[model samples]
Target chain A: SQQGEEDPQALSIQEGENATMNCSYKTSINNLQWYRQNSGRGLVHLILIRSNEREKHSGRLRVTLDTSKKSSSLLITASRAADTASYFCATVWNNDMRFGAGTRLTVKP
Target chain B: GAGVSQSPSNKVTEKGKDVELRCDPISGHTALYWYRQRLGQGLEFLIYFQGNSAPDKSGLPSDRFSAERTGESVSTLTIQRTQQEDSAVYLCASSLTSGSFSYEQYFGPGTRLTVT
Candidate 1:
């Protein structure tokens, strides 16, 4: 069984707007990481938040994690057309990592 | 430095035939992983290798699937008697370490395998 499941399987927003995606997991995790995939290519690491931390920021990306709820959210502010891609949330428990179904985001220009 | 690389970007094999996929991790990275992504599905962990430690093969779907890494460099995944349901993209990633507390992983372009 998959450990992580993302809400809102697909999302669309205009450029310059903000897009938010949520991920829920079923087990305790040491950290949560977000990645982006363009078309059929491999994933690119976006941001990572540790269990001891609540929030993190990288450029226009903000990630928040709530261990009690076993959930996380990624917010991309001032989105751009280039931001159009599939976003996935991965949870790491010990040495194992599992990925969510992913949220496909399309930022129209 | 160069990123992780996988060979034969695309492969098409007949059912019951054997197939091998290769991955080359970034220089000096000790942690390597294999994952499979079926169409419209999330990535599934297949295996993990770190340094000289024994690999974690708990994620392998079946005995037909196996992987090996030599000296922390190149790794290969072999599948025997392939089935049509095995069609998917095989991805490889490498990190500085194996545990979840380590740095993020760097992914390769992936090899698309189709069992017809």
Candidate 2:
């Protein structure tokens, strides 16, 4: 069963713009992690925010977690053409990790 | 030094046939996971293994699906009597450890399986 559900199933934006994706889960999670997948193959880990942490940043990627609402968001600043891919949010509960359906982002160069 | 690796990048099998997919996790990583992703769909967890503990197979869809791991090394997912609905990309991942909420999972390139 999938634990997280992402909003805005698809988004298109021009290069240099920013893209925001949101995810909501049903149960309490130990942490939330975001991943990026290109060509529908391997997924690359982007960032992980623990439940205790409100926000985290890595490079141009910013992740915000709200445990009270059981939601999280990922913001990609200055999006590049290469950033066109599928982004997924996974909720981790103990040893089990469930991923959302994902939001497909297209950045036109 | 090498990340997780999966074999037979692509496989095409006829319906009702059995297929096997392999995964070699990163060295020294004690946690491994398997997931299936349908066309344009999110990943569905299949199984998980941690160190010497029993594998958590709760996510497996049916009895036709099974997997085995040798200690903390290579793992294989076997699907018996495959159906067209079984067609999907099988992904494998490994982490430093599980039962803890800190480590990030490293994924493999994934094996694309097609059931004809």
Candidate 3:
């Protein structure tokens, strides 16, 4: 069973536009991490938000966690062609991690 | 430093045959994990190893799926009899440690296994 569900299975945006992806999970988590995957490669860790955190920012990537809602969102501001990739949210609990299906984003140049 | 590495970027095997996938974690990292991703889907956790403690095998799909780690350095996943459904990319990751909240993981380029 998937621990998270990302909204907008796929999204298309212009290079300068902003992109937003949302994820919802079912159980309490120690922390949540976001990862990005290029076409044929492995996933790269983006940012991690602990359960106690409400929001965090790294570069142009902004992440928010609402443990009360059991949901989190990833926002890529000022998107670029280089940001074209798949994004995923994974939850960690008791040293175990599970990922959601992910959102495929395409930034048109 | 050299992150993590996996052998045979791509593999093609036949149904009912056996295949072995390997993972080499970063030096000094004490935690390792394995995951499988089907086409157009998120990765599914398969197994995890921390130090020399027993591995968490709850996520393994069946008895045919097994993995072994040498200390905290290298690990191999073996599927006794591959099935068509087993055609997917197998990914490996290693983290600095597995205790408390710091569980950031570094990944290796996955092994694309195609079972025909």
Candidate of highest DockQ: 2
What DockQ does each candidate score versus the true complex, computed on alpha carbons?
Answer: 0.69, 0.80, 0.70
Expressed as tens digits, the lDDT of each residue in A5-106 for candidate 1 is 998999999999999999999898999999999876799999989999999999999999999999999999999999999999999888777888899999
TM-score of each: 0.95, 0.97, 0.96
Q: Which rank order by lDDT, best down to worst? A: 2, 1, 3
Residue-level lDDT tens digits of model 1 in B1-116: 89999998999999999999999999999989999998877788899998899999988999999999998999999999999989999999998974559769899999999999
- Restricted to chain B, the TM-score per model reads 0.96, 0.97, 0.97
Top-TM-score structure, candidate number: 2
Model 2, span B20-116: residue lDDT tens: 9999999999989999999998899999998899999999999999999999999999999999999999999998864567768899999999999
Better of 1 and 3 by DockQ: 3
For residue B26, model 1's alpha carbon misses the true position, in angstroms, by 1.0
DockQ for candidate 1: 0.69
CAPRI-wise, candidate 1 is medium
Cα shift from native, residue A71, model 2 (Å): 0.6
DockQ of candidate 2?
0.80
Angstrom error of the Cα, residue B79, model 2: value is 0.4
Report lDDT per candidate: 0.92, 0.94, 0.92
Output the TM-score of candidate 1.
0.95
lDDT of 3 by residue, A1-109 (tens): 5698888899999999999999999998999999999875689999999999999999999999999999999999999999999999989888778889999999999
Q: After superposition, how far is residue A3 of candidate 3 from its true place, in Å?
A: 1.5
